[model samples]
Target: MKKILLLLNICIFILGKEIHAQTNFPYYQDIQEFKKKDSLKFPPKNGILFIGSSTFTKWKDVQAYFPGYSIINRGFGGSTLLDEIRYVPDIVYPYHPRQVIIYCGDNDFAFSDTVTSADVLNRFKILFELIRKEYPAIPVDYISIKYSPSREKLWNKMKSANRLISNYLKTQIHAEYIDIDPVMLDANKKINKSLYLDDMLHMKPEGYRLWEKVIKPYLIKD
Candidate 1:
């Protein structure tokens, strides 16, 4: 009986520390064929892959704004930076794009009981480590978490996490840090109503317009 209990504890410990694998969602194949009907090879010249949480997932007008560029949005809603870290091999690496714009972590802030702000930062560190190993030359860009007019309670925590990410980027030459937090916020430090949708979390068309403007200058061919 003691041996059985010990073996069970060992199994539980191993499972607890294990990182879960990501499967290619059925929607991914559909997303892979957007704007381009022709089959193509991996590592398309100047292809820009936009990845992350709902921010990337919810970009329906991405192509309309970012024309003359092969930009692909691979956003998975309700996911954190850690989930992206686990899935990049299938979602990002296969594409082999020159540039990747990662917009996420808004949901990661206390979205799951398992992940925290510090956990998000740690996941990003792990992600950067993986990127350095797998795709050293690729430029990784981080889109800042947006201000939520309604979730005032989480605002401080959000800002703190953003600062952490910005600070971490100080050392990475290929990583570009972007923050539209100022534009999204009003003088009161709350989300600007004009920029937000009815939900107060997602952006209205105007909010995305502002984001498009900020990101336009940073995009470049590799």
Candidate 2:
């Protein structure tokens, strides 16, 4: 009887810890915007859902980029993979998207002093598993971390994470690793300054156009 009681206590403790972790998410305001948008008019089902950090959040013209395709952008600026994992039920599962294109992990390394490429990959694995558990076989496209001029210092770490994720996706049945690194590079194989805005962290129109060209081929037509 005492052993059973101890097991129950352990389970409860773990559950509590998870709940606390989720509740402490820093992007509550950003998530609230999504909720507000849904309350006004629920997004369509089976459309392409894009969720990530600033790169995606600032893409206000995403629909214009992909003509004749239903797309929903749920990106929140400055968010990490952990944020996406916490809010998947709120933002991802409800949409019933035909495909999911995620462009995160940039801020993950930017914000953390000690985070490594392996840590980024593991966080991605957690997010991937969460989606797979609910929607088996649905295509999930992972947009590789772009080689940005502003975050140039972290380029190696970002590249390592992208390579790890790309290799891992090859082993999954319905996963794709979209590498847009080359598209943003110059003839000398360096990050093209022309692709980004003044901040150099986020892409400019030319940059997003490059992305559209690369990603359009992967989109599923109606």
Highest-TM-score candidate: 2
| Candidate 1 structure, TM-score to reference | 0.78
TM-score of 2: 0.89
Per-residue CA lDDT of candidate 2, range 152-220, in tens? 899899999999999999999889999998898899987799888899888888899999999999898
TM-score of every prediction relative to native: 0.78, 0.89
Model 1, 135-158: lDDT tens digits are 888788888777677666676677
Sliding window of 10 residues with minimal summed lDDT for model 1: 13-22
Evaluated at residue 184, the lDDT of candidate 2 is 84
> For model 1, what is the C-alpha lDDT against the true structure?
0.70
- In candidate 1, residue 196 scores what lDDT? 73
